[model samples]
Target: MKRHNAGELPLSAPAGDAKRGLGKEEAAEQGKVDRYGKGRVRWSRLCFLFAVVSTACVVARHCYDAGLGRGNSAAVVRIDAVPGPPRKIIPIARGEPSEEPRHRDPPSPPGDDATSSSSGSDEPDDIDDGAGAASSSKQLPSPSKAAAHGHQQAGHPFARALAAADNKADLCGGQYIYVQELPARFNKDIVQYCDKLSPWTDMCRYTANGGFGPLLRGGKAAFQGAGAGWYDTHEHALDVVFHERIKRYECLTEDASLAAAVFVPVYAGLDVARHLWGNNVSARDELALDLANVLAQRPEWRAMGGRDHFFVAGRTTWDFRRKPGAHAGWGSTLLNLPAVNNMTALVVEASPWHLNDIAIPYSTAFHPASDEDLFFWQDRVRALHRRYLFSFAGLPRPGDAKSIEGRLVDQCKASPACSVMECSTTGPDNKCESPAAVMKLFQSSTFCLLPRGSTDTLRAAFDALLAGCIPVFFHPASAYVQYTWHLPKNHVDYSVYIPEEDVRKNASVEETLRKISPEMVTTMRDNVVGLIPSVTYGDATSRIETTVKDAFDIAVAAVIDKVTKLRRGIVEGRAEEEKLEKYSWKYPLLAQGQKAEDHHEWDPLFN
Candidate 1:
């Protein structure tokens, strides 16, 4: 439970003389003293020197291979902007520093705090000291140096690509996601926010990759596979999708002038979860209110009333929209705030009624590095001689009167052809918690049961698709009404819909599944495989090429496209009247034709 400061190294054991009783702090300080200056050579110092030498060697070798920080020159395109002058596009040699005097916008300054006091007292100290200004500006890191530094942090495979892209134009039709450099308190420092999300359990593991959590076991030979990709499982960790995607977004740029949309990387999901159980309204809403206030002062907000700025949440929109006097309940009234309502909000489970709330894909287990890896897995699943007709992998909710999970569990357990991975029989050996085990079950079955979870959407559906198993849903809201962008226009093509009414009436799920022809099942499975790429989140550690669009690509493109249209509307003075509508008529509502009776209550599923 100890909180460490930013950039502070954790304590390690002492190397020499355990009987000397030297404290860790003393040992660390002693390791830095020169032997010639009133001290003998300490073992710690020698170890430190050795580590420093090894790191330097690795950095040097990497830079050499990358053709960076060397005299060898290449052409690079640079954008030059001066106050009250027309911007010019000029070509310059690599490593050649520009002399036109770099002027950065107020919020874009390096290492600047995202949240500062209104008096502006926390402004960067370097701004006022005229004596060191020019020299300091000249010392600014080049693209090569930045890449080298990025490598040292974690050796992210995309560091080289990031360096190579220094001169490349934004590929998002010139749109870029301007990531806010907020203070640790807003995001990183508060990762311990995980520990307080709920009262009983410690949730620190969910905070990895800025709250994305750890990578999943991608495949049997993921590390050795050709075009191998990264995969991770955040089964209950929905917030991780936004955290990882924002960091890996290709259109991300630090330059404000090139930015079409800005991302406020507030760990809002974690921030609000900690306060949900507490009854105090002010306590639940403190950070959100602060975020709205700080963002309002930014020049970008003043320009468009925050229409171009957005944030993503791992939870549902309802979790943050608790209204006053109506109910003393869980969650904060964040979405109800005036400032946040003006801006867009992407949630894992969006409200069907909210216009600004965009429903994005929940993070699944497969995070492939390349298209080849994805195709390889898809082929493997297609080749699987599935033994089970259908499978269900979930815990039974016996308490809920509306839930059919218990009945499905009973039917699945009783059926000879079904492969059931029951979570209700809790123990250390529960295979349901294991990603590999769950994937194996899905791959062995023709269809994976996806009952309605506490939320409308569940990560299990995405998992089923990733494993090349057709998802069988009982509710239209489960998949048909949600994740329209990543799914086929015709839900019947990729999934099976057994209406809740039929299940409630004790209709046979096994009989329904057995009726489908083998050819039809193969077609449905193929359709599910095709959707793998779109629903999968790529590895955050590397930049891998994929033929099919991934979730990150789709989300970025959608946000930019909507922002562009909205900006255009505003320019024409029709901002208020303009609304972005679903344009998936290209894939007409095949769901309607497939089952007219099921589409009665959920007509939006057709749209």
Candidate 2:
């Protein structure tokens, strides 16, 4: 082999041969380089594919663990298969708990600490669960929707949670109330024609100042302390008064879901009062029927079927429980309605036989503005020097010749120790109409006689308590059965009960009362003074500054407690088994067996 440059052909060869030899050698070297380069490129591509697949697997695993892959296995695979650049994954913050499904009771909105302002539109928006998962397209179900859906929305988790939270922090101890926004015809329209509400007197004045009537004047000197709380309140103004008081209720919630009880402000008493004197049964019943139908259609009413629903009747239960086919009956058949039978009625006088009827005190002249004022009045009454041993203040009931009112009045007039303020049937001489004169007489007496009025109960008993006068009852129905919630359980603690029969048989009222020792009388008077707050309605114009429960407070609490128990009983399926009618007249006081009719042959009286 001759020595030569790298690309040079050997000597003594043909030019074509050398050229061809160089070409072949160069081609062979290029082939080796191309093969090696192609192999390296393929290996690099294989490594990149492996890395991408491994990264996708890790991401899919994470998505599955995070609950995003639930019910979608294809989604996990699709994450890697999508024709897009790789996405950057951000890790969750350290120490943060993983997102999980949780169920909690919902809470109501914050209550109005002061006066309740309008809650805006009647229909509220559906509350969210705070998870940001609710679709914007969803809306609160309408009443019709709720009806068709069987009140499914009432059981919504979000609403339940809100209610639970509000209940926990409620000043009313889980007793939240919801007032329905009814048509004006149901309440306000009737109130507008206050003068026409009563067939006799002009009720417009009494309806003023939130149904507390006019501010009482000329008698402030008689009241203790500043005497700023007294009002010339009418006896039948409880419906308006209660409505006004509830409007300022501290625990009022706009959301119905959170309500422990629902209030249907129908002004049932006023409605019935308008048609009471007339014989038009249709006129009396039409509005009540309409109210029943309206309430029955509500979602709130559907929740408990009116069992947890209540309203102020402002009159005796008899005023609303007119017998069917008695076209000339005394009042509208409101209480007898199928819809009303299930609901609770707070009245001035409750029926002894009806479980749904609850007795609340009639509106008295004294409405204490604050706890201090109440205490002052209590002390003032306690310190008074009573002049008369006993007193009577009322007109004789007409047409009831069997009534013992005549004998009692005669006995009172004959006794030098008794002060009698006789009321004329029709004239300015009707001392019973004057709150000032009546309270004065009651205040001056050691004991006040409480005989049966149009019904078995009388507002005078409460007036006597307000005046720190021990009540002398001729019948148990006058106070014991009617005011079980307001009065002490033992009748002897605050009142004297002499059988009506004994009084009719010429028993001496003065001699019987004089027999009670002075010390015992003092003790009873002290008890009567102590019960003033519970029997007296507070001024609705402002909130009570102290914790002392007034008549309004006591009634509302009892109603709330009752409704709560009723709802619980319904939920536990025991409400149907508890027969309220089977119990006795003293059901609330004695539980059973003791009867109002058993004493003084009172069976025919209720019938």
Candidate 3:
């Protein structure tokens, strides 16, 4: 329960000569250098990364867990669940049940004006849920109180560093959440050993979600109840505290103690009432400005480089997949886009709303996970084929080799510039019979029949382009937002975009292939091969990074990289405070919902 690490740092003690002449300012400065200076920092970092792989010493085991807890500190309890005493669980009384969820932005209660240097408290008023469970002036046992009750051990260096980081960097660095201190209303899955890593939401708390006050101490309705953690706006954060907790406060209020902070990340919903308040407009006007105002803090906070506090990017947006009668809608490949920002990449599965309306409009999946890399081509080609060929022209089923062969045969006969070419006599499972045969058969033709099959990507496009043959795409097209906008659309003028619907609407595959002009095909080929990496993956080709192992590594990396860079940038004078890239509502389906609901996710990035 001690507030500071009086036991001292874990590294080799400095010689008497090292500390001989330094004063307070000098001590702090040297400490900063020891912590983050180039070589010193690198050595220490290597040691930390090594610890992840080599923590075998029993003594080191205890120390490591105590130090490297969650995303908060390098030192804390190990995240791996180790059985220990369970914190006392207090039962929360459920309020009146309503299908309308007990979700709303709660306000923080006023704190005692007096400030405690060590505690750094402008302690919020006790919970006033019609039951004065806590008196505003009630004093706590201080750090010694928990020790007396055997609730906690003395503050070790790990705990100290964790607290220090949380205090100093909560706004932009990391947050420290001692979940056991929370009432049972919170997640029961929290491990006691601290070093465990959990989802961002699990460790993060805000005024909306009964943060800081109610869960810290005192009272019946404080935590074990509904209407908690519904904080809806920035103004409401008037009471949010970082790193430390104080005596009980009002139920569902947005106010709480102020601790050291890095920045506040908001987990927001498209709530209407709070949105109105933020906009300087009244609620019934259907105001979204308030929501924007509250969210603006995220970008503004991050952009300011306020080392003490900053927002994590502008804001993040998410919505459930709307597939009817479907229970599990996992992340669909349709969400991938090249060079898109973090907020746009979501776990949205295909739904009726997107059955045919949405196209995987990404140029490339930036950091292609194995699944994405595989799905990128296969699904894309299949979708295009389904839309343009089978469905559009009512052709034979996808597996009809005879029908496919017949189409190619017809093309050879119909086009004067074409030759009877065969990748295989067998049919659709055909390889480019041989590159030599490909050159002899397709090299003279202005357009080549670029059929995309097992290798879903447009490998045919590559061959056709290289052979001076224009590719007429009936396959999956890369949906990159950047290239399509920046590059010329005629980029594919010589090529053709025979939509799957058009193909379905057509008469015969032979007739379809034969109608295209050789000159047009050649032009299309020119553009496909001339495009940028933004146009394709694999070769016209490929995507991205160290964090590729996580399920959605890009999102996590975005958050981590932004935070790390912002911190380092501030020191280097390279960036403004928060300035995290803002992602528009990237998905058309999502945008449709946003427009319908008069909602937007990238509120912070906008005005």
lDDT computed for candidate 1: 0.64
Q: What is the descending lDDT order?
A: 2, 1, 3
lDDT tens digits by residue: candidate 2, 153-232: 23332234123322222233345577887999988899898889876788899988888889877665466444477777
lDDT of 3 by residue, 1-607 (tens): 7566857847665577667778779988998887677887789889998886675576556666677434465655336654232121111222322122221111211221111111323332232121111122223223333223221211111222122222221221122111112222112222121122222222233332322212222211211221222111221111122111112211111111111222233221212112322322222121122322332233222212122222211111112221223333321111121111212221111112221111111211121223344334233222221111111111122475423434545545564445554344333344342333343343455445544343223234433433344455553232221122222444346455444444445444445555766565444544543432222222111223221222122223233344344333433336453321232223322332344234443232222
TM-score of each: 0.67, 0.74, 0.25
Candidate 1, run of 10 with poorest lDDT = 126-135
Relative to the unseen true structure, what is the C-alpha lDDT of residue 592 in candidate 3, on a scale of 0 to 100?
A: 26
Count backbone clashes in candidate 2. Answer: 9
- Between candidates 1 and 2, the lDDT winner: 2
Alpha carbon deviation, residue 476, candidate 2 (Å): 1.7
Q: For this target, which candidate reaches the highest lDDT against the unseen true structure?
A: 2
For model 1, the stretches where C-alpha displacement exceeds 4 angstroms are 1-172, 192-194, 209-232, 236-241, 325-327, 425-430, 544-548, 573-607
**Which residue runs does candidate 2 get wrong by more than 4 Å?**
1-173, 224-226, 324-326, 570-577, 580-584, 591-607
TM-score of 1: 0.67
